[model samples]
Target: MSKRRKRKPKHFRGVYALLVFPFAEDFHLLLDLMRRFSAAVRYAYNRLLEGKGREELKRQDDLLCTFFRLNTRHADDAVLKAQAVLDSARERGEDPRKVVFGGRKLFETLRRRHLSGKPLKELKREWKEKRQGLLYSRGDRTKGGNLNLRLEAEDGALWLRVNLGNGRYAWALVKTSHPNLSALVERVHASLPYNVELSLKDGKVHATFTWEEEPTPLAATKENGVLGIDVNSDPYHLALAVVGPDGNLKRHLTLSLEEVDRAPNRGTKELLLWKIAHQVVSLAEEHGVAVATERLKHLPKGRRGDGSGRAFRRKQHRFAYASLLRKVHSLARKKGVQVVEVNPQDTSAIGMLKYAPLLSLSKDVAAAYVIGRRALGFKEKLPKGYGKLLRDERFRDHAQGFYASRVRELQAKRAQEQNPYLRRRLSREIGEAKRHLSLLSSLQGSPGSQREVTDGRNSPGVNPWRVLRVGTFLPLLGREVPRDLSPLKVFLHRGAWEGWRESRGPHPGGGPKRANVHFG
Candidate 1:
């Protein structure tokens, strides 16, 4: 065998920190510089785009001047700084223009011009003093130790003392290299303070500043494991599951809005959802595990009609699921945890049907059964008498035969039905229900046979109840397993399996042999 090649680990590049600092007198000067830089950047970008296409224009600078709704002048200043970097780069044969600009200077300039009225000289002096304090009081660097500073003008504002330290200060240099250095600086200053806290990671410098108010740390990953979450409206539930070393569920928790309401009201469900997602991310980071959820594409919606049936009036807010998934996913990524999405179709209901008979019955017994199994570590617990169950083969034979007969009945019924839409719907419903029933029936005879069966008609496949359960718990189960019985096997047994011949050549015995395949 050929030697396996070692794969390289993937690396990610991102802004490690967006420092925000309070506006000081010198902040005005920084703002002025940012405005000029922004103007320069814009001018350069426009000049490049005049003769170039979109792709070329984007490549012409390290950072692009994307305008935001908050401040027009600041946006314009960003453009100016971008232009300056391009011009400077072209003159010096260095791609300074390629450096993405920060919004520090732009915000400072705008704040000075439109919000605050601090004088430039006063602000400069204060900044100088602050630098001196950092050098002397903090003992970080000696005074007059090769401090590099520059002044620039482009967006009707002036920038002064844009300084970079020698080694760790390389980040400062990168920050200032942007055409819109002022804007970049303003953003940094807004987010972080000077010499308050700083660190370097993966070649990037991160800094934090003291602020009176800060957003509460969101719910995060714990050292134990990540809490897998599934978001829904009305009955907002969280299926908190822990992952093991092999990346399978170790323990599962099912917490709902009702449970939350049982305690004193902390906030609205939306707030709770946000907190939960953030906490999950934080926990994942702390625990060094991955948080998994389902990737929901188009959600089922109520059909528009004469407003007669419940189907026509079912209100499903697609945004809630989309937003929660997005928030959790993004938070997970930021916290350096894996956020995965699995298929959402029948994860919960199937699991419930498979594990219910083993649990004590209650209202919504099917849902509770799966939740309890997951919580009790059933997935990790192998059946006690697997050898006996396999040796008997009776359950398997009965399940296969039943599935085969039901498949034929549904196929025939589908073919005879005249209404195309109704025929397809009923066929799918009956087929899936029969397949599920067959699996449950087979599992019933196994060592753990507490699996419960729910009425097919009452439990629509995509019903919210089913959706919430599946989306919440499926990822916790880790991987899909082949059901003991399915329509595919039934079709094959009846010699009516479509696409079977296309899949492979005839065997030496001149017939196809049954193969096990897992469907999710």
Candidate 2:
């Protein structure tokens, strides 16, 4: 009999197991331990800022070890992690000297400010003032840093240990009796932890363990599934649109992340973030799709102009768009789900104008729809009622009259203004109004015997401008046109001008044919 072959599992996927302190008594010991370790990291960071290289830092590690009362290995890990952070900062156009150290709070602050679009100078100032941070590491096959902190599930009990570099280690028994934490403990028993982080939160010790497993691979194409999310500030924190493989809406969800917003401290904020991350991963995994988010990397810093009030600035500072994206992205990566960032321009406007009324969705939900459509490379939808307004002669006449009156008013204003700035502004407004009037007149098929083409595509010959104008503005009026069709191509396809001249009599050759403006 032939032996059956066993297929290897997929690449390891990362899952987090958060273990809270079982015994309240160990809290102070863990806090003091973290504080001293944080101090050691700060010391190495200062020396590195003073131009100390890895070799010099290694040689001087013992000096810091003595100063901070840390063991030799602990000191080495601190220097290594500090150097890594400094190198990363310098590479990202940030000054290494401005690096801060205040343990987990420092990391959280930087993350918050980065998402809030705080200026780099301001961030540096905050860090320079704080000058403290935590040094957390994952465990290796052998000995390593606190990030290398390890945990195991064996003999019906959870065993946690963190080597403090000498014969001494911080060991604890994590409680698995509670229903809330038992599942996480069982997971540890199933697989050895791949990474670990130890931190002091609210004066209580908490350890986060990461385990590796094979992820269910997601399809590469958008057809498989797509998740569109709109991050906003209000009653609903996230508006999500789930699209099926057939370009059909599967579900819509609005998540209220008020807790993340109302979080009173860094620890609470992180807890909220972790919860949100888990929710996102669960949704992505369930749908077997990629998540879509706005590309908000260049979001402007809060309340920059004179028009912005102090209250508005404070609100902007607390906006969580960037932080939310980061958390979703990090969790999604571990789950092997794809993340797509769509351009955020006009999403709200397009959503309000088109999808809001059609889908009977809220402004935020409509925007989420647009975001999803964009990620899927679908054409933007048009409002059903917009066509009648554009096609109505009364509406066209009213529009033209409005702009013409505006032009005259602006011209009068320009003449009356003695101030150069006011006059220039008036002149500019006058020119703009006139241009709009002219464009409208051309669109409405001009009143004069000799009609001047206002469509930007043509002139003395058969004007391709008519086709260009139709193609450009038709969509705004609920008309869908082929995107790849050029002005000349569209004109030829209709034989619009040829038919116009044929109707004018047997004159086969004449002046350039006036384009027929009536296109459905």
Candidate 3:
């Protein structure tokens, strides 16, 4: 056998170039061309479906050329490509409508032809110099100038420039004949700034452009603690587990969204997201911790039924869930927090207790439960006390130890057993049980400690916050929880901080009469 070598950690630094395709003047022309081409293709396909004669179709194609004011060659090519796609789809037992509206294959072909070309690095440099000249001249009459491009590389940083209109963007495709170049063409056509970066560690490629404003920096991660998060429409809730050396909860911080919604601006949504994400990072920095969240990405939404009403509601529910998951992921990455997605099905409802209740379980747990329920031949009744049991620090330790021993035992049994069928059955059952146990164990232990707690019901000596609700928002703190009294008790007291109006100014009516007042 060949010896396996361990892989080393890798990293890379590169710039993200934003290349704009259609210079302002040419954008409308390009849009017209696309619309004309689409209409032509659809027309031809319909003709074919109606069993039109070949000569008649050829005449129609010619007419399409005249209608779009394109040369016969271009029109012919578009017709052929569209027909080929439709024919291919029909052969594969797919609807032609699905194939036409669905853009993956079409876009893939374009990318292969246009985006894959000579090193974009060289083109980017050229564009930068031209852009500088234009800027220096104060937008002097530079007729037929190149499109503006922005370069955001690690070393050079963020800079913008323009390239002369030599048709190099179009010529690159003609020269390379690589289909991938179509991606570059399409981007340029969109008239948005674009750039690409390469990550050497995993050979991962990242592309960014004027699609949306650059994402804010909100990435965070914890070195030691586990962050339990709950996802909801109103607000995202977070709970941190600060464990002791003995794997007990030493302290925790809970954040909710009430503060976020209180902001007056319409863009409060994005601002709130950034604020909460930054707070999570700050918390992690103060007391090293990792983050955990329930993976509710595919949690079914919508009442069960067969009618269109149910379908429409389900679709809306799916959209909401998807949007929530996206925000969580984006925020998590910006914070550098290790986000572990647990299952949602059982985490919220199972074995949930008062003091360390599983407010939201990770998606992984839900996945495991799905497999477990199937393997155990149960009719899928919700697991009882599974959530609370999983959250128990002691139970988690036991489950981990149990899984390790069970795996070893299974290996030994496999080595001794002769019957393949029995061995296979036993192996599957063991695997399912282990998965379930592992998920439960994760909830039982605090985020960082390796030690196992033997008692499932014992308080981990952690202070529970009285005022903090599951999804309330919190401001950034400069210090870790105070050591004198429990942090939880302090948090409860702090929650009663005076209102903004009382602390900053008198009433709007210019009156200072009220003794005291509180609003929820």
lDDT of 1 at 290: 59
lDDT (Cα, tens digit) per residue for candidate 2, span 426-492: 6755675566556666654433312222221224432223322322333222222222222222222
Candidate 3 regions with alpha-carbon error over 4 angstroms: 1-24, 33-223, 232-247, 259-266, 301-325, 331-335, 354-520
The TM-score measured for candidate 2 stands at 0.53
- Say which prediction, candidate 1 or candidate 3, comes out ahead on lDDT: 1
lDDT of 1 by residue, 1-520 (tens): 9999997433221222332223353333333433343344444466564554334333423343232121322233334434555666688675553543333354365457544445654455443332221110011123221122222233544232333222212213222232334443453334322222233222222333222223233343333344455554434455555555443445555545454344345446556656767776665665665565655666766454422234323435322567667767765665556554554444455444333323322113233333323322334222323223323344344334434554565677788888766675656646664654455344433543422223222332223223212211221121122222121222223222222234442222211221221123
Would you list the rank order by lDDT, best first? Answer: 2, 1, 3
lDDT values of the candidates?
Answer: 0.39, 0.58, 0.38
Better of 2 and 3 by TM-score: 2
Most accurate candidate by TM-score: 2
- How many clashing pairs does model 3 include? 70
